[model samples]
Target: MNRLDNPILQVLESYKAAVWAKDVNALVALYDRDAVVFDMWGTWSYNGIASWRAMVEGWFGSLGTERVIVDFSEARTIVAADLAVVHAFATYKAVDADGLELRAMDNRLTMTLRQQADGWNIVHQHTSSPIEAGTAQVIFRR
Candidate 1:
């Protein structure tokens, strides 16, 4: 199937749109009710949809006057009959209400999705960034 017609890609597009809008409900709707997430910041892991939703809410809430723009590159997806795994390098840029860039960071993202009756739902997600050997600080650039 063409990339443009891939359901997995559609999910990613939806995710980008949701994040850009800071729509917490729309963002969490992409995941399964029992999803697990290992986010790169703030906490070790989120155990379920509720936990993940809380984190997303906090994140969107904290933005206040800023909105995040998400971009994905080098995305690779493997799909079986009912399961799929996708990994990509994701960049997030925070922009002011006027759309001026504030700051940006890059991270690695991986998600495992299951085909549900309605559509593909992310069952597991993990995001991380490399640490510099000397400074032990996160490397946010490609």
Candidate 2:
């Protein structure tokens, strides 16, 4: 099926909406109860929804609305039976109230989803930003 028409693709749209709206409640609702996340900044991936909630809440609390902007592009999805994988390049920016950009990062993201009775539920997510070759520093997609 085309990506746009796929109900599975709603997972990403919901994610974009939740992040842009900075609504943690909305964010977790898209995930499976036991989802794991390969986050950009952390000792390791989050174990489940509870851990995920704490981290996301911290992020929204710290950044608020003015600082965080997220955009996703080049999204593609593959579905087979009860499994689905959606991936895209995401650009996110953090700006101060003065409109000064503190940081910006573009990263590739992949989410693994399972078709449940309700809908597709995200079970795992992995995100990685390209490193600058010259400086050997990560762009810090968070």
Candidate 3:
């Protein structure tokens, strides 16, 4: 099957766009109502879309007037009719309104999507970034 036709792969475009736009509603719509997420900044894993909203909101809130750019790399999707698993490396760069990058991070990402009547919805997602063992410094870029 053509990868372009995969619902999980197709939804990623929407995800990327929503994140860049900082549209919490749009981002939440991409997840199942009962979706669970393990976000990089969240101290604990979020259980359900309701809980995930806070994380999404916090990200956008912290930006103030700044904008963020998101990129995904080395992404691969495996599908079995009703379910799809995707893994990738994701990068987030926060830039000032004037177009200066304030900070950036490269993270490991995994998302599981379920094909529903509407399309594929992310049921579970996990995001993480490694830290240096010696200095306890986060490895922001790869």
lDDT value for model 1? 0.94
| Best-first order by TM-score | 1, 3, 2
Against the true structure, candidate 2 reaches a TM-score of 0.85
**Estimated TM-score for each candidate:** 0.96, 0.85, 0.91
Candidate 1: tens digits of C-alpha lDDT, residues 72-118: 98888999999999999999999999999999999999999999998
lDDT of each: 0.94, 0.85, 0.86
Candidate 3 weakest ten by summed lDDT: 1-10
Who wins the lDDT comparison?
1
* lDDT measured at residue 21 in model 2 versus the true structure, 0 to 100: 78
Best by TM-score: 1
Ten-residue segment with the worst summed lDDT in candidate 2?
A: 1-10
TM-score, model 3 to reference: 0.91
The superposed Cα distance between candidate 2 and the true structure at residue 91, in angstroms, equals: 0.9
Candidate 3: residue 80 lDDT (0-100) = 90
Pull out the clashing pairs in model 3.
none
Q: In candidate 1, which residue pairs get closer than 3 Å at backbone N, Cα or C atoms, i.e. clash?
A: none
